[model samples]
Target: MHTVDHLETLCARAWPALAEVPLGNWWMRAAEGFTGRANSTLTCGDPGMPIPDALKLVQRFARDHGIKPTAHVVNGSPAESGVEAAGWRVDLDHPGGAESLVMTGPLEKFADGVVESRDLPGWWELTAGSEITTAQRHVLGSGPNVCFASIVVDGVVVAAVRGAVVEDVLHVARLAVRPSHRRQGLARRLMGELAGWGLTQGATTCVLQVAEHNEAAIRLYEELGCTEHHRYRYWIPAVS
Candidate 1:
């Protein structure tokens, strides 16, 4: 088992941002306008300056990249108070939800179906649901030693997932199933396929992030024997 900081570090590597800079120990990341995790400052460690000054740098980095300033902080981190005192508020309107839970367990426990190769016809459409952007392609398709998993039916991809093994941890994301195939366990199977592949790649631990409000996903992860390791939230400047 790894510390919260280590786990967070692994996740950052798994879902890398196109641009990243280190401030003290904090990571300022950006990927055009991909996702919050890709475009937020990971407030994991001390920034080696006053929190408010560090936050100013965070804002500058985000604005420079043409993204709204945001910070990702683990719950209970000492940095939280300083951020709030600086007038940053929790981004309750965040598309992914205000906060997310990091869940983890052994990949072998969830191993099931055979993993498939990358870019199976409808996989991108299913995952993105609309036009895919350069940032999405760069961040999702090109991660550290990444592999994609999919389930096909009648020559069409009905389910898909993205998996990457970073230092023995399998980071799973973007699991999507065709609407017509919902509740048929396709999501679980696709995850299994990814797990099988990750294990082969020397991954023993499986980690994924789910929105705190996503009860259904939480139930699914719990059923897979995944335990909540920690929760994180995004913060943005409070509106005046």
Candidate 2:
């Protein structure tokens, strides 16, 4: 079993940010406000200083990048306590959720399909609302060993997912199925395709992050034998 910290480190590489700065053992990441995971300080390990002092640096980094002063902390961890004691509060307004869980399981190989080095227009059409932002492209395209998998039907993409292999882990994200294509197991197919692709790359396990409130997605992952590895929440300076 991989420790929480080890798993987090792998995921960090799987979905890289445009900028990653180390604050002692902590990681401060920024990607032009694209996603919280990429745009917040990750309070994982010791920072070689008091928590309050570390938080000051975190806020300063946020201000320098024009993003929220946020920290991604594992729930119930010492870092979480320190951040809270320093007047940081859980971010209930985060678009993803107040809390998120990491799920992992052994990779199950399925069938092979076309994989892309760069996201296609259909992927952007399915995942984003408007023109793809540079920050989004940076984060998505920045993964060290990443692949874009999708299922095309009638010359249109109805489902898509991203997979990145970091060490022996396959980190999956950007799962989406067109509303009209739901209930047809396209999501599973895409996952299986990614699994096949990952296995070829020597990945033995799969990991993904999901919001705690997303029961449906959790159920799908559970069916694929994934279990909760850890839960984390985004924190920000208290609204005082």
Candidate 3:
């Protein structure tokens, strides 16, 4: 199997969607339109049936959920061409609508401080602040093995990141820094804490997804010794 396929498979398991249904070998995910990752079909391996059948299943699932059907296709995968042939165009309105790079690196690179685990309330307050919606809470708390890592300045949480370990790979997400706390290496510090925690759970590598157009984040990941492992884009049904 390709490295991207492996990484993507691990990612799907690590960051599970709110609801999932099997369409042959594909996974149809829905999360009340929270984000593309949760709302789109995950075309990881062979869809197990004809392209038309798969598309129809996607449509039915979306209709049942009252969401516009979308497919998450890996770049250069056979499913990508199949979906495009079925009149599924890229979802331009979605964040990172074009393509997103999957980055990976050794967990040791960021394995530094001791990572502290927090309950939902503490994690939400530190990372998302107040006024978070129900969907966001569901997504953030979906993972079975998720940990929220933070770096405290004085006594306040200034930098935070989320990590989930699946199949021995650490899937990092939601790395954030307070506006007044940027450019002080807090992001890196958060990564170190999370990675260190992951290592204790038998994780050897780390992976994360970032939009291709996010140069700043891309640069930061690269600086942390992360490299592109794969790319993927979302496909929405073309309107007649």
Worst 10 residues of 1 by lDDT: 113-122
Clashing pairs in 2: none
Off by over 4 Å in 3: 120-122
- Model 1, CA-based lDDT: 0.89
Superposition error at 175 for model 2 (Å)? 0.1
CA RMSD of all predictions:
1.2, 1.7, 1.9
Provide the overall lDDT of each model, using Cα atoms, as 2-decimal numbers: 0.89, 0.87, 0.82
Residues 61-159 of candidate 3 have per-residue lDDT tens digits of 999987879899998998988899988898877865568999999988868876987654545776666877776777777675888787777777777
- For lDDT, candidate 1 versus 2, the one ahead is 1
Candidate with best lDDT: 1
Q: For model 3, which pairs clash?
A: none
Most accurate candidate by TM-score:
1
Which parts of model 2 are misplaced by more than 4 Å?
Answer: 109-118
Which order, best to worst by lDDT? 1, 2, 3
Q: Write the per-residue lDDT of candidate 1 for residues 39-75, one digit (tens) a residue.
A: 9999988899999999999988988899999999898
- What tens digits encode model 2's per-residue C-alpha lDDT throughout 130-215? 58888888788767788878888998888988889999999999899999999999998788778888888998999999999999
Look at candidate 3 and tell me the lDDT of residue 6.
76
